[model samples]
Target chain A: MFLKLNEIGDKIAIAASGGKDSTVLAHIMKLLNERYLNRKIFFHWLLQRYDYGLDLFLLSIDEGISGYRDDSLETVKRNQLEYQLPLKILSYKDLYDWSMDDIVKEIGRKNNCTFCGVFRRQALDRGAVMLGVDQIVTGHNADDIAETVLMNILRGDIARLQRCTFIKTKSEETIPRSKPFKYTYEKEIVMYAYFKKLDYFSTECIYSPNAYRGHARVFLKDLEAIRPSTILDIIHSGEAFETSAESNPTNVTVPGVCNRCGYMSSRDLCKACLLLEGLNRGLPKLGIGNTEKLRKKHLDEKEKSIGEYSSSKRTPGNPFIQNFNDLKLGSDLKKPL
Target chain B: MKINLEFSGGLELLFDGLKQTSVVVEDSSLKNLFKKIESELITQNKELFLKDEKLRPGILVLINESDWELEGQYDYQLKDEDTIVLISTLHGG
Candidate 1:
């Protein structure tokens, strides 16, 4: 019901993960597209009917986790065939020159989810830009939003806590991303998929065994079991929270483009650029946690290794060439002098 | 008593990647049927399917294509050749 399809503009893409929620979202949108275009007279009385010939496509991001992403991509392909919607698959390797597998190898399993989570958010935006879609919709259900609200509160991340409950998020620079299933229940999504015999991939990431969100999810699900309304209750509570300016003094700053990749960033380098630099320099921890402190450490390490340019030189052994320059990603990092 | 059980949404992994199985139970109650399936059918990750002698919170139970919540959840009576589907909603979105 939160889809607000008419406001989503003509060209739209669903950020499908091939999970049950996204699969259900894709299927629903496809069905709606058919009805909205083919039977306009039936919905003529509705004030918010879709435009003529509504365009819908599925956009998927391949994080390149071995056993996880490859299998899921197959499901997305099948969905493409079933829904008769065009599909565009973009890989982390193509976008960032680092797969989740590569990130895990360099940084170990501890904080790789950070890399993936950050990379995927931007990957979806970039993919949307490439597709020239007006808006991107994700299958983030009420359960997901509620869990995220709990997580933000638990982590005391007031910034995100303030922003997590919105049904649609928009900024001037990027494509608007919205949640069509904002009020939908996770159980309902799975049931729809099951009853329809929709194909979906449903495996946990092998590297995300210890993700912090998993704990929040289990806790939320437990609460949901006890009271089915807990999911929406949490969301309502999050929206009702009037975080005072006394608690969170808003940081007012103009957003600028990353010097390295030209992505929108408040700082000179975006998070992805910083993370990529860490991976390339063999200092995988450089981009994670305490940015200023890590930048100091990275510069100190670069100073210590100045005599050896081998670290800066792209590894001949690693087959995926750093395509940062090719993609207008990392054209600005000067060689260690 | 006999029942058909189906697992999906990654619960199949706990059943050695098997999606469906038929098991014979000594009783006609859902609880007894789960106990039988737990002992006979489940090959790995029993905890994912059950916790503290109950179905895990994230898993949804359907009795003959209806929501188990509406059908008495884990206490529903099982008839001969009934189909019960257990789907795990815990996977990534």
Candidate 2:
């Protein structure tokens, strides 16, 4: 693989998840740089702080929960000390002041993984952008890609299925994303790590009750049980399949920026902004639920006022009543606006 | 009017309402069928449907192998044998 290092440039950032896959990826990149690329490929490690409370879960305590108290801190410290590479640690708290419990509860509400995935991807992109990197590399091995392809095909996710092929790079974005190990397998990565005796976290996240992936993994494993080459066959099939570019459509960009949070969205208010509004209104389901209730409430009040005015037949000379009606109309108009 | 509802990928789900269940589409579009299914699911498992915030993330609803979000809204047109697959996103890296 070091022979291929000449094709890659000097400025690269390896997305290290502190797991076997990413650890091996980082090591491989480093080896390529040192052995063949002449150690010129300047690399940085970006780690996301997913506050799973794994330490608490593992140790069964919640007394100390800050940065210093984090158990992963030692591992990160050791990595930084050994590798001498700059490591950026990003947390959800830094992005949004929500506890792990709060996030889990919120996600549990929809049973949707979109929130976390979007947030993490955005964080990684933003972090990479801040670090002034040209390209970002992730440890998305062949097995991961194959699994994703299978998952997409199963769910009939045409867009994802189409886009899942090859090295994806969004030039319009601040920093482009790539996967050197996109053609590599998870088992190969594990074997490489084991062969080299690399230090990495083996435990799964305490909260990852990943039912879907677990099912897919088991199915793949079962297939592999009958034929070990099935994994590579799936990867080869994925590689051979040509995704038509015209069929896949990107997200439609909105004209205006979000008033609350300046994230790019199709509407004037993004989902996060709407969520914040729900939080502010003390009704978390305000945006999620049937919005007709909120609209009807205003309409009902307006109808009541109109009925009262029509029945009372207020005199044009009555200044107090006129002012009161003006105030009422103003308040009613202000509700949705 | 009896249409097949199949999930393509290897998603092993123990659906409570859909037991060898084939639905009849009299005058409803595919979107309407999904609405019916959603309502049925809600009725069958109110606890799951009630948690809207957590449900939207990572869950992709596909009608006839196309993403509902990309195609039409939830009310997109439906053919007789169009399969609707609900896929939950993988969490681990």
Q: What are the lDDT figures for the candidates, one per model?
A: 0.77, 0.50
Q: DockQ for the candidate 1 complex? A: 0.79
Candidate 1 iRMS, in Å?
Answer: 1.2
Candidate chain B TM-scores, in order: 0.91, 0.56
Give all TM-scores, in the order shown. Answer: 0.89, 0.54
Model 2's CAPRI class is: incorrect
| lDDT string, candidate 2, A231-316, tens digits | 67876776676546565444333345443344445554445544434443344554554556753553344444433432354333
Q: How far is A187's C-alpha from truth in model 1 (Å)?
A: 0.3
Best by lDDT: 1
Tell me the deviation in Å of residue A174 in model 1: 1.5
